[model samples]
Target: MKMTPPVTGTLELAHLLTRRGWLRTTEFNTPDCTVWDYAPSLPDQLAPEQKGAPTAIFLDNTGESEFYFVEPATRTTQWNPYSRNFDRLEDLIQWLPVIENWRAPRSHEHESPMGFARLRAQGLITTSEMMETLEHFPYVPVDPDAKVPSLSRTVAEIHQAHNDKLLSKNEFKLLTHNTFST
Candidate 1:
């Protein structure tokens, strides 16, 4: 499937899956992409056979990606058009709430684009990280039965997500203050 250039890789996959009726329609974001690795994750829920499939782990400084879609009956990890490899699916899934809280549309909340931009303009997210996410999309593959990461783990891995740069300084400040506020 042709992916959307402006949208994150996870959104591209989520859009495809949602369009195909594989998952319920919901906002997609970096954190959401991260948390999709649980045994009860959308993929496993959609296709129970995929549980326990072998997973490919991809890692870097910023974050990681993973790939583990396989037909349980076949017992082979299949790389669909949208598969990524991460050190652990669990770490990715853990970030879902954060991303969602930060980016999802809400009746009373402003979108993160504005906030992210503000933060970028203020030099909070860092120009280097922004450039990286833009060049290489970060996504994770979910396998229900894959080994979970340890409690000592942080973000299974790290990758660049420059898309955050799209937001203006005001927008980013609003996003961070609103989403991350105590």
Candidate 2:
């Protein structure tokens, strides 16, 4: 599959899975979904054969015999290594909300992206950390799953979203306000 260029890698993978119409109906109907980020979390109902593994930022069906997973970076069919190395989504695609046609419609929401600001507000990602990260990388997406030189056990594992870059000087002021005494 030819992936979109502007928003390739992780963002594409994220958008494809969460977009309005891409999930398989029955699976979507299951209503037990979680965007896995290495933490072992699940919905109220659990599938007989489901457990949290060391997933970075993929979404998984918490109730499938095959330990079903959706890779957040590649959006490929993945199953538990113990159960099966590979699985095909051809069958599941039928019930999907819509065909996998990549199109990032221009929307207002796209204007301002959601990222580390929340983490910074919560004191998870500090201004110094963001500044430090900026020094190394001119612009960095707020994806915790992203591989970083320095990281703590933060909630968002901003996976290295190569396509989406955030360059904001104003952000530093907001995040660093409390760092300095008024």
Candidate 3:
């Protein structure tokens, strides 16, 4: 699959969240409000309008602001409290919830489609289990048993090194085609 564009707004929001000590977890709740964490690195598993969508949504149970989402395709950050979309981080920050004990968004909204609505009501999925192996695993080397340092991570490092002038374009291109030696 083609790599999606990185969302600066998402990172900016994450930075803002970490500063508040929310921490990452399946669920976080307090007397003032509740916060559910999620990432957009995975495929969408819910809402008909959102089926097959690749996006990240982090939401709070507080009623003031419904939730926030960053769509990589559009590079837009949206808030569903009243269905408001904001391109500027500052606009949302001023009204962002402080995190406390509160109720989460309702699971059943008359306007939502069945499949995605359930997933949305449950919060985004972070983990999954697949007992069966795929017919072909592209990331794995031709030798099904071949192992090395994480290929994806290694590729990232290779690109970084190339950007730092440690590797030429030809070197970087060739390196990507072969498994990392170290």
Candidate 4:
């Protein structure tokens, strides 16, 4: 679907989401985009399968944005591998309600630690930003049948790497701040 750009800036998008009864949980900025994660304030507004599912709006500098029905288990680990891209902000706003019926992609195996490293190597995201995401976002349990590593274990590994000097002081400090503040 296509629509005109009704939103001009990140702040405007945030306000629009807030007015729609979405609670902003976290905001993260990468070199290329700003991501705002949200959850419906009234759970009943979502389909039963979508209740408690998180959503995100990604605004990039190139006048394009995306809206995503975030897979709960992959929210913190992946850089939104599953999303509906929109060239206009209005298209995304118009698509939000319909998102309740949208199913998260079944392909979550791509969100491993190696996937994050690939994104960093490609300069799609910064190390500090990734660390902040890992530290701030709580782990969401996956279906018992799904085969995936424990997110808390992965986060602890990241913490240990930071302690081992694998990351710069500033990045470690950011991780520390996110960890303590939450």
- Best candidate (score: lDDT): 4
lDDT of 2: 0.29
Q: What's the best-to-worst order under TM-score?
A: 4, 3, 1, 2
List model 2 lDDT by residue over 1-182, tens digit each.
33322211334444555563333333232333334232211223334554422223223434333223432211122432211111333332331221122111111111112244334445666656444332222122233233321232221123221123342445434423422212
In order of appearance, the predictions have TM-scores of 0.21, 0.18, 0.25, 0.35
TM-score winner: 4
Provide the lowest-lDDT 10-residue window in model 4.
Answer: 140-149
lDDT measured at residue 124 in model 2 versus the true structure, 0 to 100? 62
lDDT of 1 by residue, 139-171 (tens): 223452333222111112211112444544553
Q: Which stretch of 10 consecutive residues in model 3 shows the poorest summed lDDT? A: 129-138
Q: What is the lDDT of residue 128 in candidate 2?
A: 61
Q: Tens digit of lDDT per residue, candidate 4, span 48-120?
A: 4442335555566633544333333232344554444555566566555544333232223334333443455
Collision count for each candidate, in order = 43, 9, 9, 0
The order of the candidates by lDDT, greatest first, is 4, 3, 1, 2
Candidate 2 local Cα displacement, residue 72, angstroms: 7.4
Q: Mind sharing the TM-score for model 3?
A: 0.25
Regions more than 4 Å wrong, model 4: 1-9, 25-27, 40-53, 62-81, 100-182
Model 4 accuracy (lDDT, Cα): 0.46
Which parts of model 2 are misplaced by more than 4 Å? 1-53, 56-115, 127-182
